[model samples]
Target: MGNFFFVRDYCSISVLPGASLTIGNNVFFNNYSSINCLDNILIGDNSIFGEGVKLYDHNHKYGFNPEFSIDKTDFKTSPIVIGKNCWIGSNTVILKGVNIGDNCVIGAGCVIHKSIPPNTIIKNGQNLIFESLQK
Candidate 1:
């Protein structure tokens, strides 16, 4: 109640002992928003996670090991970094090794696997025309 507040509902947050989930100032996590940080997951200040947004830093490797494969992971984790002033839409899945820059808008229901630069808008499977909005 004093200053920082974490409002969660129907969400399972399992951070390993000594593991960290850093929530910046004025950050809000809505209902059904789950953050599974096995390593280090940093959510920037003033960033909001909408309903049903899932962020996982770990993936399961299913193949036998000789060299390595991205598709096969035995529950390994890297790190998730989200910059400040970012708006994450609902039902968005932010995968491992993703560094989202500041002031970026992520469209709803999009699976982000790579890093997004600052002030960038990502929209998948939609035809959008970028016309001048001002007269």
Candidate 2:
């Protein structure tokens, strides 16, 4: 935690044996932002995490019968990789197995899972067709 920039209630995090979270240098995180990387999560440097940004690295597997099985929940692990100099907007949910390239802008209210290419600006309704062009 030396020479790092962070703004949060619990900047230096301490988790149990089963939980994990890793942050890089010059990273900016807003308040109430939570990251649960039970498997493997890696964040690049100079990335901005907006308010209420949630990140998960595991998904529950529910295929067993309710009465016979004693295990209530099962989890599958996936790694989340965020490239350097990225800007994650507010209230965004970054799911597992996502590899975001460098200098990308993740829009607000986005539910992301796919691997986004480098230098791409992903937006909602950025290309809208108002009228048809036909002969």
Candidate 3:
């Protein structure tokens, strides 16, 4: 962490043992944001995040191993990298292994599971098909 601009109240950043959370200079994290770093999470300089944003660097592994079948803590981890000057919108969920490039704008309520290129503007739901379940 290097000269973070501000971290609002009720925001939680948890780094487990042997894991790492790296935040660069002038970064601003809004209220109700959470970052769970089970491996490595690197946020670059001049980045700003909106409210209720969540970032996770690990997820549960779905393989059926008998001994650890009932264990809900069995997880696989990867790193999440957010590049410089990015703006992440409210209620966004950035999952494992997502590398967001510089100067990007991610819209609200987006679940980012893949990498985004530099200087991109990503918005929500242009192809949303809301089918009724009234069969």
Give one digit per residue, the lDDT tens place, for model 1 in 1-135.
113546668866779766677778777777898888888888887787778889988887555467655564347788999998888888899998899999888888889999999999887686778999899
Give the per-residue lDDT of model 2 (tens digit) for 1-135.
Answer: 314868776433323366656667898888778787677777888999888888888777655474444334567778888888999988888898899999999987788889998787776545656876886
RMSD of each: 7.1, 5.7, 3.3
Clashing pairs in 2: none
For residues 18-51, what per-residue lDDT tens digits would candidate 3 score against the true structure?
Answer: 9999999999999999999999999999999999
> What order do candidates take by TM-score, descending?
3, 1, 2
Better of 1 and 3 by TM-score: 3
Model 3, C-alpha of 106: deviation from truth (Å)? 0.2
**Native-referenced Cα lDDT, model 1:** 0.82
Q: List the candidates' TM-scores in order.
A: 0.79, 0.77, 0.88
Winner by TM-score between candidate 2 and candidate 1 = 1
